[model samples]
Target: MKWGRKSMLVAAAAAMLATAACGSKAGDSGAPANEAGGAAKPGNAILATLGEGNDNLQGKKIALIMQFNEGAFSAQYVAGVKEQVESLGGTLQVQAAGNNLADMASKLDAAVNGGFDGILTDHGTAEALEAGVKKAVDKGIPVVAFDANLNVPGVTVLQQSDEEMSKQLLEKMKEDIGGKGNIVKVWVAGFAPMERRQISYKAFMDANPDIKEIAHFGTADKPALDTQNQMEAILKQYPNEGDISAVWASWDEFAKGATRAIQQAGRNEIKVYGIDMSDEDLQLIQDENSPWVASIAVDPKDIGRVQTRYLYQKLHGDQTDEKVVLEAVMVTRDALPKDKKINTTELGEYIEGWGKSEQGIADWMGRSDK
Candidate 1:
């Protein structure tokens, strides 16, 4: 169960074949314009173009079971899936397990027995949902997972390259802090992606012995509030400008909290780095006094659309990769709007790949071949 960097590389190289193209995303008019009179390309819009054969999806019943529905990321992901499913004339049954494995198990069972054509498990784990996934697969229901490593056969696992992402963020932190400093780590175990990222994190920490980890903590549920409280306590405990040189958060929510705490403590010297990007996360980075430096960006909406499209392909007898590992990029304060407020949709414009990865996948599937 130990996911090594070598395995991560192989999976990533294979998955890269699905997202190599770069161009205007699906719904964009591809016209040239500028921000001069506000007629520029709108970044905050649904980016995936629906496939032509939605008629095939008409009347098909699909189910999306989520492990938790706590943030804008989850909302956007479901919105992307709903857009695709409804456009294709299908009805999607949405259910949230609210971080309860038993609830996830029950939902999976219900979806299978209720005769759903396809099932999508979002942000779950194999230890919790494997049996349900296996039963659904055995019943011939096409199942695709987004960020869930459910080790069940015949299930397509879709996720971003977490290990590589962690490495990128940590490397950035190393550069920013001059390779050696007292750092705090925010993490929570039992999640698959977090576990993989932990491997990458440990490797980085071990490789750099001078970087002392002063404390470790994380938050869930009300992540923004809880993380802020935890970090504020950490700051109070350390209580010095350079005592805490940097903080490496496993995810953006934790980073946001840490950054807020640092800002409040007036410890601008402490830089915060993390994985995952959101509009709010970028807003923090855009703040002139913010301690957040950078993070790995993965558009949840794009991920939802891509996984759904891949599921569509699987249903239509198209052979797809067993695992679809997404490509992600680093987004810094430099890439965000300087003086104005921006949502995730608008924020995505600054990321290199943005909506293009799913478009590439759809293009490769010949969804636009007509």
Candidate 2:
């Protein structure tokens, strides 16, 4: 919960299993390069790589139940999943659980009993949805979790490499600030990814004594606005340049808020380092006078595509790994084009290892018409 103060040592140690993965995300290369995180579809071209389509996925029903649909990340992720399902001729129903834990649990239970052929969930805790997920598995329904912590048998869990992302971001933050200074942290605990990320933050803090944390505040509610309000208050408290060296935002919403606050306060002297990505986040980072420098994240759309593909694989009676982890890329302003705006689909050209993944590509799940 309180990840910043005294209880960070154990979390630091747990976060030490650093990821050693990098390459092109092959699965997302199926479609034509699309711009922006929104309105892009990773087409059927990837079907060329798979062996055959069972044709069983067509006409099947899918239920995508989410805990929240906030920001460009969630929207683009949902868009990817929807388009993937449609390309396979499957019907998808998305349920938004908002901010209520009970609502999240009930959505899973409803998906199970609602006669859907397969289910995909985004961002719910094992405590709230484990029983329902277990029940779904027992009922012979295929379930895939994106950024959720449930580890039920017969279910697949997919997540970005959080440890590596954090490691990448913080190392850069340290370098940007000359390896020592005060910073403010924005993050929340409870969600799986956030918890994983905190591990690296704690470890980084422990390793670098010169890097001092001056303030910390975060929330899942109206994350960007809340962070802006809090960060604005912190700016006023410190007011002078160099009083805060940088802000470490574990999520993009926090980064957006912090960057806005610092810019409004005319504090470009401070840098903002964060995790997660989106088109809007790109624009912010690319701003002429923006303080948001870098972000480490996987393409959110690819996350959805991978999750849905795994679900379809299960439907085709193919075996898939219980855990699917995608590689991450550090998108820096220097790496992006000065003249053109790009989306996750086109990021590979500018940022290395952007959309590369091999998780759900199956020999039995490509298009038969081809």
Candidate 3:
């Protein structure tokens, strides 16, 4: 994943078109923005689209505006978006909001007015995105939103089953801790998925009166590093065995941070459970004496691909659902492969119900876009 000089040049060239692409800082949204997952070259080199009716995506200019662009999950999701768009003969560029809500809102406005044929929005609040989404609808543009809390008509809202993800993670944590213990919660509010996941978190806290929350903390910016720093301090404060039972992370980044902090302190008694998983996460889970024990997540890449497919379907005048929720999967340390390292693609073999879904697939999509 090291970016050499050549890769940087390629990424810069690929992102040039997206300078004014989707989100706020990337263009004239009043702040400076950069492209997400711009470490690789774009796939506009060899573009082709084939199908019978309403399947033509070639030459379709697409924009992906993102408010959060960090971690392996986000990288894979961006990869999926880029790959799907390229496969279907469309061009895509990513615009980053740098975790700023106002910048994200401004990016939405830029995408609406930025001449993008289709738009893909990632992680913004309802208050900031509704008016801009409504504008896109008025202009007859198709939009596929990922974890953005917008109720605008004609905008396809896509996300993982947030409640289900939380439910599964919490259920496992409760079972592991015997339903009663002191635990820390790592989460941030305002993002659509985080908000929905909080629903179950709240319910879990209420339902389990014995499971007291010893500490609660999280942040959107540099989440893993920040969480590690904070967790280290928290560990010192509660410097005794059984003082903390487990750490429940709303996102994998937080889990990773807390895991490192816990492991470095040699707190083998403490465990970590989280939402979302990646190759790095899996590796950490399998690491000797690692504190990260379990996580629940949908395929991040599949989310992006499905989001792109929905956008293509909408642009083709096909009727689609207003809400699309991807299925979630739980991965525990016990379920991990013992002999080998498995990336996301090979995860389904070990974990049940962990593969791609046919949510936005259509007959017109065909086998190949060539």
Query: Which candidate wins on TM-score?
Result: 2
The candidates, ranked best first by TM-score, are 2, 3, 1
TM-score of each: 0.82, 0.87, 0.85
- Per-model clash counts, in order, read 0, 5, 3
After superposing candidate 3, which stretches have Cα over 4 Å from the reference? Answer: 1-35, 38-50, 53-55, 368-370
Can you write out model 1's per-residue Cα lDDT over 1-370, one digit (the tens) per residue?
A: 1012222333232221111001111111111111101121224434333456545655778788766655544555566666555545566667766555677778778888887899887776676678988888888888998777667768888888888988988899998889889998876655677777889999999999989998876545455566677788888999877788898988776777788888888889889887776556767788878989888867766776777877776676666778888888888877777768776666656666775554325542333210
Q: Largest lDDT belongs to which candidate? A: 2
Each model's lDDT comes to 0.67, 0.74, 0.74
Tell me the spans in candidate 1 whose CA falls farther than 4 Å from its real position.
1-54, 359-370
Candidate 2: misplaced stretches above 4 Å?
Answer: 1-38, 41-53, 367-370
**Backbone clash pairs in model 3 (N, Cα, C under 3 Å; residues 3+ apart or in different chains), count:** 3
Over the full model, what C-alpha lDDT does candidate 3 score relative to the true structure?
A: 0.74
Candidate 3 displacement at residue 56 in angstroms: 3.7
Model 2: how far is 135 from its true place, Å?
Answer: 1.6
Ranking by lDDT: 2, 3, 1
Mark the 10 consecutive residues where model 3 has the least summed lDDT.
16-25
